[model samples]
Target: MSMFAHTETNARSRLPGGKALGGLLQRLGLGGRGLVIAIPTLWLLLFFLIPFLVVAKISLSEAAIARPPYLPIWEWDDGLLNINLNFGNYLFLLEDPLYLSAYLESIKIAGISTLIALLIGYPMAYLIARSPENQRNILLMLVVLPFWTSFLLRVYAWIGFLKANGIINNFLLWTGIIDEPLIMLQTDFAVYVGIVYSYLPFMILPLYANLVKLDQSYIEASADLGARPVTTFLTVTLPLSASGIIAGCMLVFIPAVGEFVIPALLGGPDTLMIGRVLWDEFFSNRDWPIASAVAIVMLFVLVIPIMMLRKAQAVEEGAS
Candidate 1:
């Protein structure tokens, strides 16, 4: 046997718990592969499933003035167990136009931001992927350089550029492009800019990773077949890179949907988003049950896109 296998067998023999665990796994018709899967399964159970269940429980509870700020769903009275679940929180969300509007606006903003990032990042990624090996690293470094700075600072920096008397306006005035400073700050436009700017790297990196590994022979073959460059790119390159595009868009969209800082800082009062609504319900209003309900609903809303992404990934894998 290999040294690694020998050591593993000896360790299992020496450790009673390991031996018992192995035996149990064997009886259950699981083996080394199951052991590998178990780590992530346990991690998700502990971190994701448990926390989600906790939030779901809270969503079914009533807001309270006491500690934890939510009433328990379960109670014991006269040695009998009683269970109460409040569905009013979800109903309240549906009844409130503000919540619905916020949800719509959040989705709209995130969607637009993701599209913009894809547009900007796709060319950058293509260039990087096609570049000489030595220059590729430098270009990639520049793409990710913003992350080296604090995210808040980067958003704040945009304020300096987007404000009426800020860098952009000043430059436009100096260049005689405009008569006066344009109002860009504290607007949905600024929020879009922030989201696109901050998440561009997320879009670019995935595309670059995908494009770099792409078989150039496909493109060359298309060209040899007398296909025009644009046609080849449209039919061949873009189709192959669909997975990367979806991944990048999802990365940008998912976080952008729940983004608090960008909207809170750059967006005007008119620019209502679900994240702001969630913050208000949780902190400003101290309505834990409502907040939990909003969170749960938002999660459900995100799950649709996540499921679509998973399906696309599965299809891609099957095709490969």
Candidate 2:
């Protein structure tokens, strides 16, 4: 659903060449490839595409708050169908600063958290990638193993650590780091920490995948050419792993933009993200039209970058 909503990426098909391409000519319907292609496509069209179209229609309509509410795109009047698809929901967003600020803050939080995740995750991924062959699998497994447990449980664990009376402060006070427990829990800092911690593995995996493929010869060659370590990194290593970076950024940023769980649980009263706003409107206020409008706006934002990342990956794959 997110993929379809990205508006940023266009789904592309790759065809094999030479004998493989000729084979397609002979057996276009071979095996269950026909169904393999058809079923998911049909499912996406039926479920995702149609639902999104309905939401888009709603976003273009007025916010009708009546019971069993629907903001219709048009109405029947004077024995003719009149198009009343005014952008009231979107216009309201422009008139009010609160909604605009929340959306901007959501993007800022997500972007910064993604950078933080990458900063921490990259060194770990690099270390793991450079480990001995025998130990690498175990290390990689440890990174992924946390996913087997409930995510909610993991976030809940942070509560006990970040809360005012949490164990972390108790230990810190016991050690005399400060006379008082710091105000961490239920703040932006806590939210940032939680997000980075939770999303670290997602950032690490792609980086590891790319790093594992990076030949030491590249570094050796650069060093042998008298390039400084930092110079080599800038000129060679980073550029080579661009695809992985792009992929990881997309994976983290896309979901983080709409994350309600982390902010609602860990964030304080000041945390006003678009995801929370969307949830409030749709479920709490039962303002479906406004909620749908928010969703469309988010979809529009994600469209360009996600598509660019996909295109970059395609180019990288072609080069490989």
Pick by lDDT: which candidate is best? 1
Q: After superposition, how far is residue 45 of candidate 2 from its true place, in Å?
A: 0.9
Residue-wise C-alpha lDDT for candidate 1, range 33-113, written one tens digit per residue: 887889899999999899988999999999989998989999999999999999999999999899999999999999999
Residues 126-239, model 2: lDDT tens digits: 899999999999999999998778888888889999998898999999999889999999898988988888888888998888889898999999999999999998999899
User: What TM-score would you give candidate 2 relative to the actual structure?
Assistant: 0.85
68, model 2: CA deviation in Å?
Answer: 2.8
Prediction-by-prediction clash tally: 0, 6
Can you tell me which runs of candidate 2 are displaced by over 4 Å?
1-37, 65-67, 75-79
**What is each predicted model's overall lDDT from 0 to 1?**
0.92, 0.85
Model 2: colliding residue pairs: 6-303, 7-303, 8-303, 8-304, 8-307, 9-307
Instruction: Please give the lDDT score at residue 203 for candidate 1.
Output: 93
